[model samples]
Target: MKVHERLDQELSKQGKTQAALAEAVGVSSATVSQWRSGTKTPSATNLVKVAGFLGVQPSWLSYGELGGKTKTVDPKQRDAYRRECVWYHRPAPQDAGRELGNAAGFAFHGGLSTFGRETSQNILDEAQPGQPTVEARYTLIEISGSRLNSFLEAIKFDDLKPHLEAAADSRQKVAAVIRRGLSALADDGRLILLRVEDYGAKGLVGPEYDDGNYMAVVRNILDSFKGDNAGGSYGLGKSVMWACSQFGMVLINSTLSVAQDGKREGRYIGRLELPWHRLTAAEAGSPEAYAGPAWFGEKDEARGDVTRSYWGNEALALDTYLARDEDQPGTSFLIVGAYDPDERFQTIEDMHDELVRALAANFWPAMVERAGDDPGMMTALVRSERNGVTIKSDLVDPHSYTPAKARMLRMHRDDLTVDSLEQPGDVVRRRITLEVPKRLSDGAHGSQQHEAVLLVTEADEDDTDANRVAFLRGSHMVIREELVPGLRMGSRTFHAVVLAGLAAGGEPADKAADRFLRAAEPPEHDDWMVTPDVSSSYARGYGTALKNFRIEVRKAIREIVGRPTRDLSDGPDALKELLRINPPTVDTTKRPRVKSAVGKPDAEGRWSLDVRVSLPAREAPWRFSPVLRFGTDSGAAIPVVWEKLVPETRCTVTGDVVVAEAGAREVRFHGTSRADTHPVMASLATALVDVRVYKEASK
Candidate 1:
């Protein structure tokens, strides 16, 4: 393919004037004319940059080759790299036009845009006044419900086989409709977490990230596919998946996503970056800041007369930090690929259970809003016709659990922070109720011990008045300082309370068997079992199991602040918690009750607490609206809310979860309790012995 001929075709396809294309690539019209006339070739380096801007591959532009190379590397590093790329980068190239990074835009059907700078440039002239600046990013975050099912569906070779048989080509050609849907997922993430409209002006809050982590995240999510798994039937989503990534090649888009809910989160598009010699954080005047004028905390800060979306610029009057790294840049898709049951799940049934938990994690409120009052609005990735969808969590928590008792979980504390990253973020605490069946053992579908898994880390994070009032009329919490895992993985001090039902040995014994038991010593009898079979009797038992389980789950969730799982196979705690702390019911008029109980340590390596303390709540309402608020507290109108609480629904977190911890040293936990308590009796029918060290006493 002649480079000049290809260039003209792309210019015509992009509906852009050559002059306009020259301006975007920072090349003179004369240079473009030369390349077009075949008088001269673009330098390899310039070609690469130009290709990126046009959403084409340098390999295609330079060597006229196809099938961008699939990365192969050390598995662990590959997995980590994939997480960063899939969650941070834009979608991968899926078509020939995309592979070429055609600037004229691929022949993608079904959508048209009047807003994007690229689109406008294609329709208008260069640097025209009144033209809006192109966005630095347009990202998407996607999560799947049943990995087995999604993966299975993604690999419908039989269906694809027919298409392949008809054509000599075996390379996949995704239907345009499918591509649009996949694009929608990534688009939703960007729209929710990065894109914003402030006072009639569209804006962005996320970084125009150009890092390894981001690129890998985008690639893993938008590239890889799965073959066979428990519930997966056909691999249709794969077509759109590849198309989504390639779209960015031409549009400067980057996406970040994870295959499994809690499996990974990071940049997907940026992983396409080639490594540089060495880069680090350097002092400003001693040198390394952006060269030009800027603002400290002003909304829509301009960058050298260009106002896209940048927080820091102008380089002076502030402290600076630099980050430098060493390594020849490469990419991987380990975690992103490994998550899809790559021949090691042990059993299909076990894979199903993992899918349930994955779906139930419901952690992305910015992407999809879960409303219990309005079940229709409670969108989750884990949806089924009969039950509903599960959601992935995003809090980046390191908590774990086990079945022990039946109890009510409630709100513990909701703290707010302002000026966190030069700005502030609010902190909230949730206390939830979890149910534990008396018998403790595992099973195919439902295990008695899994009932009490609070899964609070995947619960909600709410927005309220205290945070807004403290910051400015429209403030929301931004996760400025992420709670990183301690050297001892789960060692952070997570303040929580397990409100067990009377059945789990609470003050008031509340039992579920007495109210819904099918027989005596239920765990031993097949009739009383929740997973003993597919018989009518099993279905009957499942009904009773769901009924009792939902009550405790709902109560526990009311305290969680963000979106939750509406239909969880185990406890449904995630969904219930999301419903509880949605802020609509927030009576912020009251002060958050942060109670401290006085305690004294004893010689037996233990401590006892008995002190008078008041956890107070004083209701005082202020502006709770996001953005566009006149400020109930002040007459001056400002940007109402900080973006985090209601962040543009994109996957912002970009990392992997370490292994779940064991023993007292571990901090947050999720699991069923050892004993079940009779709510009516307020005592466990059985005795307990396992103890977790919530904390140690000070000397």
Candidate 2:
């Protein structure tokens, strides 16, 4: 039937005028007329209203009559809305190359919900770092905008506040706590905390800048380590922190360089200030070359607010700013006006650690001598709920000791050098070696250096041409076409250069090194049979220094904060109070001090403490074997190594291959050879096993 006829019939039956129907249906009469003429179709929702106005159910207006229910929504519409809701709740990418739609993915925000706030990253990334400003120092504009402000607010760090306070609070607190507990344990007089975690994605970084060049500046600084340009490279991990902050990052940078390096040598401490100012798009260049270094040609390094205490421009000479005076100099940062991190990164340690990790990747000690693994430096990363003022290494931190000697070491490179003890020019094939020593390693760990090398790799074994490996006390050993058998420090031997290479006395692992021992094959054109670079050697030295340093520092920190509890929530105030001490009463008669010692000091004459070590007595016999299996059936006739001697070793020991029968189970030992009785003799026990296994023949 024609829609007009049907509509006319309906209207006639209902006794309703066009205007009345239009009003009832909440639309113009023309719309109703068009629906009737079939020029346009009434929406399903509208049809239902029309049917109600016409005294009929919606189904009767179209297909058929309905008992009681209202017409259903469009299937396509229902599907679309359901899909839209799903999209709204979907998750974003977590890392790179992520895909959506499986379990979790894209989500839409409610127009008025807090989730509706734009989450676009505030890319502080400018093509050129400090493009708006000149030099490493930055002075940024006060960022403003709703979303921008939200991001800016997101950067606020309540956790960072305690850390900043601790960095500034009297070293007395630092010292007292360290002294009362472990500070005295440090050979030098300081402690450091390092935390490393990756920046999930590239993040904003650069110093403060009032100039419009924020974008360029950020890019330059963040990518500074790339060193692709003619300009000086900077570590933006620090700079960006300075930029977005109202108050500048604190500068506590200290150097352990002996006094000779001149201006950069020694310990120093001071505030790294960034006073705020306005900026424009044209200023990212050398200040002297472009704007003229002199401030208005009147004041030198004098910014308008130069005299303000909050400014970051105080320049203290190295010698005068450290140690005894208390405020040691080192790099510390506090950012202002930044996007707050997501809940996933709610703590200051998280934020700071993320920045550090970015630095770990960006600055990777590859450029520095003696780089260690992917982490680069063996830093002691710590997270503290204690008011930060009491932060000190636990006794087990990686960094616990001496700045030199017997330190935890990371091997970067090594070359097999055989200078025949008695002959000249008598050469041997060079072998490269990389070693991460379990003994010299200082850091407490998830996977500790307490064991020998965690891994090892040979050229042929690793197809990529890289020395890929992880080592443990008795892990599988990889041999190569170039290998020759020998003996080494308690382990199978190879060459000293190889050991040195891995031990910090050989070639240092630089940014480009690919092998564990920095055992790179020298370019064909080079003629030296084996040569280790000074850089590599220095790297070994550095690792040694770091290991020792960590040990020393950790020793001190542990002494400072002792006594672990079921509750790890001790506040910083507890540490401060622990460090406080009232002076002891004195008679003043004979110079109040310790009386003469009842016992003479040891030959070393220094305070010494007992050190303990636990050794495994019996390592379960582990054997790699050749197997023979019966096809289909579960039985096979084979030599039982447990009862028989190995063909080769048996000939060497007993001159025969005979042994006790398999079921007898009475033999003392068995192996590829009869001499295998001593197989469990761990080489490391050569010096110390006697101490643990036997009581000193009493009298």
- Would you give me the overall lDDT of model 2? 0.24
Residues 282-384, model 1: lDDT tens digits:
3122222121111112222243322221111211100110000111111111111111112233222333334333322221111111111101111111111
* Alpha-carbon TM-score of each model against the true structure: 0.20, 0.24
Candidate 1's clash total is 159
User: How many angstroms is residue 387 displaced in model 2 relative to the true structure, after the best TM-score fit?
Assistant: 6.6
For candidate 1, report its TM-score.
0.20
lDDT score at residue 179, model 2, on the 0-100 scale: 29
Off by over 4 Å in 1: 1-240, 243-447, 455-540, 556-699
Model 2 lDDT per residue over 613-662, tens place: 11112222111122111111122222211222232111111322122222
